[model samples]
Target chain A: MDLHQLWTIVSTPDNVPIVLLLFVVPFYAWYGLRQAFANDRLIAQLEGNPEMAKTHHRKIQPFKAGWTREVHVWPYLLRIEFLAAIIVTVILMVWSITLNAPLEEPSNPTLTMNPSKAPWYFLGLQEMLVYFDPWIAGVVMPSLIIVGLMVIPYIDANPLGNGYYTYKQRKFSILTFIFGFIVLWVSMIVIGTLIRGPGWMWFWPGTTWDHNRLIFEVNRDLPDLFGIAGRAGKIIFGAVVVGAYFLAAAVLIHKLITKTAFNRKIYARMSVLQYVTMQVFLIIMLSLPVKILARQLFRIKYVWVTPWFNI
Target chain B: MPETNGNDGKPAPPAAPAAGNGNGAGNGGKVAAVVAGAKAVKTRAVEEMKGAIKAPEKTDLWKSVLRVKHDETPRSRALGVLSNVFLHLHPAKVNRDAVAYNYTWGMGGMTFYVYITLVFTGTLLMFYYHPSKVVAFRDILYLDSDVPFGKLLRNMHRWGAHLMVIMVELHMFRVFLTGSYKKPREFNWVVGVLLLVLTLLLSFTGYLLPDDQLGFWAVTVGTNMARATPLLGHGGPFGPQMGMTPFNDVRFGLLGGSIVDSNALLRAYIWHCVAIPIIASAFMVVHFWRVRKDGGISGPAPVVLESEIKEPRKI
Candidate 1:
């Protein structure tokens, strides 16, 4: 984006965080992953090789001995935390002195600003309002995220990487979390902040919001695209599509993520019902990004819209 | 001893030992006398200086407060943390790996620090600020223009708050990446996530205190989103079917009325200045305590047990 656009985004209190998260998430993920991969290459290579793993483990055993020691928190952990606090205080002092917080005219109900926006952190949810109805965008997704976060410890079964960093052991979790936070969350914020203009119309970053600009977006769902007319026909067709999607995803995950022996062991460990529930959860979570993409790229909204609600 | 005269015509004390004494014995005696005389002169000088500059009496208050001693044994170090008021939040001992600068990156600590700053500055700002729409904006103007360094105080509080939100998010990110949230620390992780939510709530409530267009509109947008919340919201997708109304909805409860007005301002003021902070503070205490209870930040698996098992094999 050009400097004008950057300044416009930065000046807005809400958009500032979106810009910051967009930059920070990738840098941090890169840093964490880089450190993990660099140190855990041997661990990665030894995965799934039972015999070679034992030999490699023995080889590295001596070097790993001195990695950690118990030390007094008074001068170690507490001191560092205290120092960090002081540094932040100093930074805040400098920042506050340099930049005064924005305060516009008092609230006037008669006048509405163009692109009235939520705070930057919630911009992702605001952007989701484009693709999904308010209930799904504002209510369901947030509740799911919060509950999902709380339940992660119970759901994840791999027990190896508890007390240390290990990319090979926790690749699935790390990658999945990063994808959700960076791609789905932060990218949406960026889109909402920079691309969205007056009346929530899509605008390029360099362009200014123009009241006279005429924009039209026609969103066609599967039923409309396929010329399906009756409500019964649409309901049946929608159910089939949604069902087929989950079924295909479940089969693919089972076949692709595990070998025959591993698949059988997983199935034995978890009952059919539990396995199906887990697969369905994954399908729903993965579908969020796919739906967003459909809305953005193909102007497809409301894959299934009923009288009660739209999805 | 024999007496001798100096160039200034003053007689010196003693020039030489008696001729009757043995050479070695006499030399030793001369040396001893000289040494005694020198010591007396030094003592007199010290006494004179002591009189001129009185030495202050020592107190144990600082030493006791610091919980430190010259003899720093392992037990003393542990006691230092346990007994010290500030240090007691942390465990007596921590894994060295946990404190590694690159590992935790000190984000959690920084968040705590910023919150404290905000509390201090926010409390100060309250003295000059009134929550009424008319005075709220004027109060800010007064702080910036009339009150000396009022602008600085306001700026610090405002910026510290924004910084705190970012810090809390980063801290959670670090916790996730290191997998410190797993196992025994899972409860602490939940507490942390709750703290994150509270941080955002505090930020949101604080936004409306300025009563400016930016603050007002931001809150409007935020509470509008709340109105779309299912079941509890008047304008929610199922609000109509659920028999929800503007007077009884979640958004109304939050804003204290249908629209952003005096009630909304007062509600935000209470939430921002009092309610959310107290809740956040309680959660922060639990979060820190749980860290200690969970045996401190996660680090490398203890090698002692593994070494014990390997010791027998070597033999």
Candidate 2:
């Protein structure tokens, strides 16, 4: 879309939600990346010079007894906690008084709300239903995420960053999780909560969620978009694409990123079984944005479809 | 014993001699004596003020109510924590690093505080609320309009719930960024994640209690998501094919029927007020206890240079 179209979309009341969803990620990513880079540079400088490193360490270290007078909960932690609670309580009271919690008409199961939504936290999962089959999006994928998060500590062998927040010590894991959390989880939530309107259609922020404004577009698989005629051709093409992605990721991670001996040791320890599973999962996750872009830009959907599932 | 300063009750040096020639020296000494006498009186008053404000060490009215001591021994400190309900969750001593605002963002503490606020406000709301479908909405309306500070109570609970979720998520994010979930902390991290899920569940179930359009539809759509489970959900791919009826599906189990009805309301009520709270509280206890047992919240490893590694005293 041209700048004029973009500006019109943003200017329209109906497109307010769209504008918010579009803007949040790029802004946050830009900010987060700059901060991370600056931190990395500072840490590198400190580590390169021993005297400077000692000073930096001392600087970051919180006040010793003489400096800050740390105390027990009787006077310290409890006081801070209670003060925070009181402040929060006061703010909550003002908010509650000024803006009432929404209470709509009593539910009627017969008349489904035009654009039903889950709570904000689950909006990301709900939005995924647009790109994947329900079995994958709603059930298996969510289950995997919870399980994956719980298992991260066990699988990640890097031990240098257990106590600190240095990105350089744990770059891959930090970058990967950040991408998943922000781009996949948070961005999708913005879309589901704000942009989606009636019939699960996209609506801009200022626009009313009208059922009549639905845009019904045909979404086709990648093979279909490319005019691959037969089922066999599509399957072969899909397999080749999947294989190529995994191969490329494996080679890149191993060759380009795993330069240090510690990194190579960790990579070697991730036997083929572990490496392939993790790589495939990562690629599938990374492909979600690609699939979303394809659907939005080209109106292509179901890049891969089978009797049991579609992706 | 350290000499006490008459002016501040702190240790002070002995009074210096009045400096003067013989003629004025006697007057200067007299003036210094008067000033010292005034300082002594002020110090006595200050000591009394400090005593009055000091936390009670032993309450004869209820001995069990106060257990702390001004001069704590190892045994008394442990006993002080063990005897009190609130103090038991915390370790007697905390590392300075653990309490640093930037290290943990104080998010975990804020979450606990918010949770307590939710419980307090939620209980007050429960006193005014009735869980029936017909009266649920009316009860809320009455609470808002008719009851005294009822709106304030509901508002605090509502906003506090939202804040709790935000705090919990931020806490988890902080933990992730700091790599605080590694090593011996792995299980505590899992517990933390479970607590997060429980918190969301608590918020979700409570959402339906408001009985308005937002809660009703949100719950309806939220529960409907459960029906997409592959073989278990009645509306899922193989569910209908396998002859899975609506009554037997996961959604049905959640709502206690094929649709969101009275049973769903009661279930949400029970889950919100009793079941989830109990489970969450148990997990929270474990989470805190483990934090103490696991050597408190993680901090930066002590800096030791490569050359200093071999120097025993350098560390």
Q: Which of the numbered candidates is closest to the native, going by highest TM-score?
A: 1
Which pairs of residues collide in model 1?
Answer: A14-A120
In terms of lDDT, model 1 sits at: 0.72
Segments in model 1 whose C-alpha atoms lie over 4 Å from true places? A1-3, A11-14, A42-68, A232-240, A252-281, B1-70, B302-315
Ten residues in sequence with the least summed lDDT for candidate 1 chain A: A54-63
DockQ for every model, please.
0.42, 0.30
Error of model 1, residue B181, in angstroms: 1.8
- Residues A222-246, candidate 2: write the lDDT tens digits: 8877889787788777777667766
User: For candidate 2, what is the total of clashing residue pairs?
Assistant: 13
| TM-score (chain A only) of candidate 1 | 0.84
* Model 2 lDDT per residue over B1-315, tens place: 123544454433333322212224477767766666556556666665554456345434334556455456655655565567877777655555556565666789888888988899899899998889889999999998999998878877877787777668667766777788987899999999899889999999999997877788888878877787877887677777767788898999999988888899999999999999999999999999899788876764443322332211221
Per-model C-alpha RMSD: 9.5, 11.2
lDDT of 1 at B66: 63
Model 2, stretches more than 4 Å misplaced? Answer: A1-46, A50-59, A62-73, A207-211, A226-262, A265-277, B1-64, B71-83, B303-315
Error (Å) of candidate 2 at residue B50 is 16
